[model samples]
Target: MDLNQIRNDFPTLQEEVNGKRLAYFDSGASALKPRVVMDRLAQFYEKEYSNVHRGVHYLSQVSTLAFEDVRGKVQTFLNAAREDEIIFTAGTTESINLIAYSYVLPYLGKSDAILISEMEHHSNIVPWQLIAKMNGMDIKVVPVLDNGALDMQAFDNLLTPDVKFVSITHVSNTLGTVNPVKEIIEKAHANGSKVLVDGAQAAPHMTVDMQELGCDFYVFSAHKVFGPTGVGVLYGKFEVLDQVKPWQGGGDMIETVSFEGTTFNVLPHRLEAGTPNIAGVIGFGEALDYLAKIDVNWRYQHELNLLDYAMKGLKEFPQVRVLGTVPGKAAVICFVIDGVHAHDVGSLMDMNGVSVRVGHHCTEPLMKRFKVPATARASISFYNNKEDIDQWLSVFPKIFKFFG
Candidate 1:
């Protein structure tokens, strides 16, 4: 897949950190932006900077066209049925919250329950807890097995008629376990429940088709997928999203406003309030364009190869215990070394110019379930190669020596 060319696209990889070459293994938190995306952002701000959707002036019109064109790009990215079904928000957290407040809270009754998993990020879990508490609704959790895969039998048992909605992560940020979201969506639909899939981890690694998955809602952050931060997507089915009320009231989200009353705009804009992230959205379109040039299957297989190589290396160290050993998981390794704190391991790795994420990763519940206070995670991307994994693994000996 032209690995050298791919690495060259990210200028950060060329830089040195602490006199060592940077082995960036933190793609799950946020991916390194490509040169094209950054250049596009600069171009937009320099020449076409203006507030979208109002002015008839040339810059505003240009800005508006460029910004809205991204919505179409996202629609194509997810293979959604309609462009209007895609809503822009701050990030995945905001997207989930918007659904909780705008759709689920208004439609579902107090007695209805929402189902989630132990592996969900805090973004997926907390919003439901907040709304459920306020509305006197119940939240059900599906258990994770010892191997970090979901207990599908338990999921089936929990899919009772009382569950009005289900929210699950497509790929776990901590465990790297790819949940069977398509199957889960089908089951939930059969049982008369809608579903939302958090694709923050999955979208960067794989392709997600809306018509194929048939999820009521799907969300992912642009930064995690080689785009800019402060912008993300919420893909909802048109029939379902059209029925939900607007979560916020402000400038562009309205059809009309008077002292008497105010009416809202159509599908996508109805949900996006105020001045949207114009530059970020335009850059995100460039990111999608960048991704389209690559083959999806090749990317997936390359990441799996990286995962296997890293796992094999980690297995050689008796002190290292890797979490989430399920087959076909994403290219993320969350491991804890014996007798060393995760933060210490992270610091040591950083000194070696091998970046990794350490802590609960906003999945405190998953950490508690796994009986670990925290873990050090190295998440991979298509741009990473065996040399990066070698650098990551080379730090283990130093870690063990320091702890001993």
Candidate 2:
């Protein structure tokens, strides 16, 4: 990938943060939007600004077409079996909550269990906890090994007929571990349990094939994948989505409304209850187009190359301790500088034009499991390169002096 060409597409990459040239390394939290995505959002509101699927006028027709076009692009992107299986939501958190409330709450009971990993983001963890509590179902946790890979042996023991559902994050946002989701899905299915994969981290950094993974549900946010915020994708198997009741009620999601009873609309419309984020959805489609035009393999390799450079530099820091370096890890390096809190290291890095995430990253349970209060995370994307890692390496050593 051409770093100069890619950098030109993201205007924010050149901006100064904290009075220093920005070196953003927080792609895992939320990626920076490309010029195409930004321009698409602007053009959408400027040209086709109207409520979709309700009015019969020209503006509505244009708006509705733009909105549904995103659904088609997303369906193709994930290789979903059908367009009706894709439902849009606010973001990853909302998408997961939708699945939990719509499917898990209604189907699971006292004898059922929801299995998850200790390394999951809060989006993947708390939703199941809430549904399990509401339905009197048990929440089972699969352990993480020392290298931050999910304990496959422990996972095998946990997969039993009692497991009603298994929800696993496709990548650990904190650990950068790429999970073995296809195998996990197959095992879960054998035990008669449905599966959900949170692709919030996976879709942005790597290609995702929903049909091949064969999970019951797969969810991800648009913003994390270089699109606009307030839009997310939730892909479910047709039969599973058919059985789920709509969580929210109102607007175009109804066939007949009455004071006594209301008949809901079809599968996807049943779940999408309200006027959706039309502009954001349109921008999401543009983002997908932008991604498709680029060579994704080259992008992945670029990110991995930067990760390798950063990892090598970080290992040389006498005080630094790198977190999970699993064999099949993605583009993330979460670590803690010795004798200094992660927050302090982040502050020091900022003074030198570096930006990194420093906190629990919404995985409080995983942080506790790792026995660290928090960690400083440097997550790279295609826009980043050896120069960015070199800049970080040049600045990071001062953290010890700044705190000493």
Candidate 3:
């Protein structure tokens, strides 16, 4: 990958923050959009902008084609069996909520249980919690090891015929631990339970094939993959989606509606109710195209290399404590300096022109489990280089002294 060329594509990186060059290290929260993605969005609004799948006019036809084109791209991106299996939703939270409300609520009963892990983000955990509470079902949490990796042995012990569904994150946003999703899915399937892998953190770095992974459902946010916010992808096997009912009701997802009754559309359309984010979806496709051009393995290697470098630097600092030291993890390195609050660390880093994410990272449960208020997260991306790592490392001592 051309690091200089990739960095050049993000115009914001050129600007100075607090009299220093911007060093963005929060790719886990959301990645920086390349010029290609931004330009694609702008071109759509400037040239072909109209409501999709409803009109026969020129712009409408163009917009509809562009929208469906994204489905094809996303289908290829995840290597789904068919384009109809991909459902466009708001984000990972909404996608999981849709599954909970539409599918799980109907299938799960008093004797059923939904299993999740302790390292899951709130997006993956809360929806199931609400669904389990509303229905007569129960929620089970698979324990995490001291190293923050999922306890696969404990998971095996927890699995039973009563487990109706399993929801797990591919890569932890907080701990940076990459779960063994393929093995998890196989075990869940053996017990006749469906599996949903939250790929919000994994999709951006790794190549995900839904067919190969064999998970019943997979979800991720577009913004995290260099696309716009408020857009996401949900991939479910056709047979599974056929069994599940629609979560929302309205415009496009219908075949017939009358005073007495209404019938829904097919696999994907049945789930995508109401008007969609037409422009955002097109931009998402462009982002995927951009990603396709770059070597994914190289990108993964680059990000992981940065993580290792950053981890080594953090280890040399006496006051800093690393969160997790799993063998194979994502580029997310979350830590807390002794005597300094995560918020203060974030603020000081920002002032020093090093952007990093701080706080519980929407994982308050995990924070409470670890007995820390929050941790400052330095997440890397493909575009980042050693200079960005040096920028953050150089400024940490000052932050430690300020809080000390």
- Write down the TM-score of every candidate: 0.99, 0.98, 0.98
By summed lDDT, the worst window of 10 consecutive residues in model 1 runs over 129-138
lDDT of 2: 0.90
lDDT of each: 0.94, 0.90, 0.91
lDDT of 2 by residue, 1-404 (tens): 57798898999998988887788899888999999998988988999899989789999999999999889999999999999999999999998999899889998899999899999999898888877778999999999998999999999999988998999999999999999999999999999999999999999978898888999999999999999989999999999888888889998889899999999999788888889999999999999999998888888988998888788887778788877878979988899877789988888888888889999999999899889999999999998867788888988657666677
Model 3: per-residue Cα lDDT over 211-300, one tens digit each: 899999999999999999989998999999888787789999999999899988987899988999999999999999999999999999
Tens-digit lDDT track for model 1 on 208-254? 99999999999999999999999989999999888878888898899
Query: Candidate 3: deviation at residue 277, Å?
Result: 0.4
Residue 322 in model 1: shift from native, Å? 0.9
TM-score of 3: 0.98
Residue pairs whose backbone atoms clash in candidate 1: none
Please give the ranking of all candidate structures by TM-score, highest first, separated by commas.
1, 3, 2
Which of the predicted structures, 1 or 2, would earn the higher TM-score when compared with the native?
1
Q: Which stretches of candidate 3 lie over 4 Å from their true place?
A: none
Q: Which predicted model would earn the best lDDT? A: 1
